[model samples]
Target: MTPPLEITPLPYHEDPLGYFAVLRDRPGAVLLDSGRPTAPGGRYDILSCDPLALLEVDGAGRVHGDPALAGLSPFAAQQALLDRLSREVPESDLPFLGGLIGYWSYDLGQRLEPVAGQARPAVTLPASRVGLYDWALIQDHDRRESWLVGSAARRDEVLAWLSAAARPAEAFRLTAPFAAELSREEYLARFHAVQAYIRAGDCYQINLAQRFSAPYAGDLWAAYRRLRKATPTPYAGYQAWTGPEGERAILSLSPERFLECRDGRVETRPIKGTRPRGATPTEDRRLAAELEASLKDRAENVMITDLLRNDLGRVCRPGSVRVPTLCGLESYANVHHLVSVITGELAADKRPMDLLAAAFPGGSITGAPKVRAMQIIDELEPSRRSAYCGSLGYVDVRGRMDTSIAIRSVVAEAGRLHLWGGGGLVADSKGDEEYAETLDKIRHLMNALATPTNDDKWNKKDLHLVDRDIDIQ
Candidate 1:
């Protein structure tokens, strides 16, 4: 049987990411940061590592575990993990104190194909994955409160580890020079192709994207710090792990929340329309106003919102799905977007993963009439999305969950960083304009890469500690 977990309060008030940096090198470490400051002068940051078990779906659409789980379809495999974990840990009053924390890749959708005849691009990364961590550091920035949560047997050890990690650490260096996988001309051509599909009535809208990569030879933590500073969003995260394939890191500065389920109520915030931030305050207000007034943009946002509502309806109580907010404008660091919120109450028998399966590859990123749009995406895009457009967050033992749309994210593996940027295309979309919008979306990430790092920022001289093993109680 799984041991009972415990939570112990701490008095530290330093930057959560800085504390996370000390543990980032540990396998299965995950940092979920609400980048912007939260109410009462605090933000929420969760740092966890050393998963008790890991649930992963491989590139070939195979689940890694018991025969029963592996034999089930990929989406079913994910749901099984959630079900088993909840049964093992039971519900907790603390939201994320002890639960599964990880990500779901975009390619996991392949398992849900209604028919077997469709072709799909190959994915280079694990298709769908989640990790069940035994220990975590939960920080509430507003209240200046922090807690080390773990099994009761290991409380003393966990507290000691946290106190040690509170000390400063050495800084690492990183230099990345990025190159776009698709040239401007090539991206424009693809945009036109998506428009052709829309014109053909294959779909009214589709989200098209391009990939960019840079060779890196240094510290990923340092780079992530710079990224968070450059583009602070409500949903920012960093994940590090070492598997059979080697070490991998994912850094995300996403502004969109794909799903949030609490107390059996599910909510999705889909972002469909985007406009670049203006050079001046007046220009910014004008751009936001223009976006609010654009019929085309509003229509696009509504379409995705409706799509999400339908998705929620599948696992939610019948007639419970509703659109509470429609086409609201939300401005971020680099862009202003048209967003809509959809809410529903999960059916009595449904699990969190049921809601995830019904809405995989979020509607905002896929376009209207999701399945058809996805097929077209496979045909038009040269490669698989992998982690892009996927969801990353935590599913608590209580079954409460929250995940962000993995846009404006970077995947780091084998000393290379991969990034993607894209936009939704409607029948009236212009190829050049859409391509430019893609550039605007990735501007902050690119800037973070270009900005040089300073060694002095780490203040490593003060850290006189060595790494110690964290013993779970």
Candidate 2:
């Protein structure tokens, strides 16, 4: 990359998120990697996120164009990155390399694994971003968790620590089967009705949600044993921790990226389309093919991509934004998704928070004209989305940061568990298929719980057809 850009030194200990923050304050892109940290048990009984990385930007919005150098030793490698940025600043007139750091795991799937042989001095979750807080004392309100700004003591610990600190670990039950919200036909009918309104230009995309409930209270930690084996996503794990008010919250599986900024550059990936992996190879191929060929998925992805570009344009240099890839097929353990990638150069005058404010929740997950979609989602879904649509990652002491889209996840709370699923709504979606998609996501969660899979668990025939991406749940 450009001789490593120099900003500042990282924390003495492992602080993946903290490193990002520090890098942001200076220059250079900060590469972040989150390694796996299992619980005291041989295998972690519960976890929230898999593992991930964040690439920050410099003031000139320059890029280093390498993902491998991040694996080099922290000391020598960081110094090198600084040297590169130092050189670039003069020529490009940028303040980029504020030291680069990474928090990574070997796998971003079922469980978090350590990077192979690279960490000469390994460590636990970073102390910088976690801040000092009483994570163990928090409550578990699984439906939707929020990002609670932490206090001093809560610092050094990871969110998963909440599981161990759970007041009564015995009470944690990941699966709580809830009553079906609507008859199949009825739900479908509402979906189509909403589509008609969308066509009328009254709204853009609306998020339709449903709530599941059970007489007994439980959460995802109890459900993940089987799910881990069946489908392990670095993002599938949980972020169970106590909030500032001392309230406990558990985030379900999520696959979206909200906002991440480093040095002065930033990026976000919002997933807008999905389809479940099939039961067999042939079926899986067929499903994947259908997802790719389906106009719905393409339309949804492009719309979101355009929306993201506009959002990025606000913080980036003129003509510095572009789509690196679009409508690409991404395969995960339990599902097949159509995804796109967008890149941009940040403006010299931009602040990290401005990137977030411009694109708080990702457009892919929320839909165009995000606020309208959110209002509709609130009306339909059963639970409060405290953190389902929020982000999870680190803001290094340097200023660089990376957060994820909380999808395919569960929220563990006060003896209760909550899981969520959603996508874009368009004209031409089949009511049955759309309704089934939600179940497909929930099915993955139930499978994670080690529960028997139901082919026709929730009936959707009563819900009449709306439009494509049949939301209005």
- Best-fitting candidate, scored by lDDT: 1
By TM-score, the best candidate is 1
TM-scores of all candidate predictions against the true structure: 0.88, 0.59
Clashes of each: 3, 118
For residues 1-473, write the lDDT of model 2, one tens digit per residue.
Answer: 22322221111322122322222212112222222231110111111121222232221122222465445432223233433422222222111212222222111110111112221211111111121111111111221122212222332243323224333223333232444445566567767866876888756665565444332234333344334445554443333343332323333344445565756666666566688888899999998898889887788788888888998998888998888788888777677877787777678876554465466556776666655655555444433444455455443334455556656555444444444555567766666777787777666555445343343243343222212222112
Could you give candidate 1's per-residue lDDT for residues 12-91 as a string of tens digits? 65467766866776667888888845211115678887676677788667888557677887666655565554334434
Worst 10 residues of 1 by lDDT: 464-473
CA-lDDT, candidates in order: 0.75, 0.45
lDDT of 2 at 287: 89
Off by over 4 Å in 1: 12-14, 38-43, 65-68, 83-93, 114-123, 165-176, 452-473
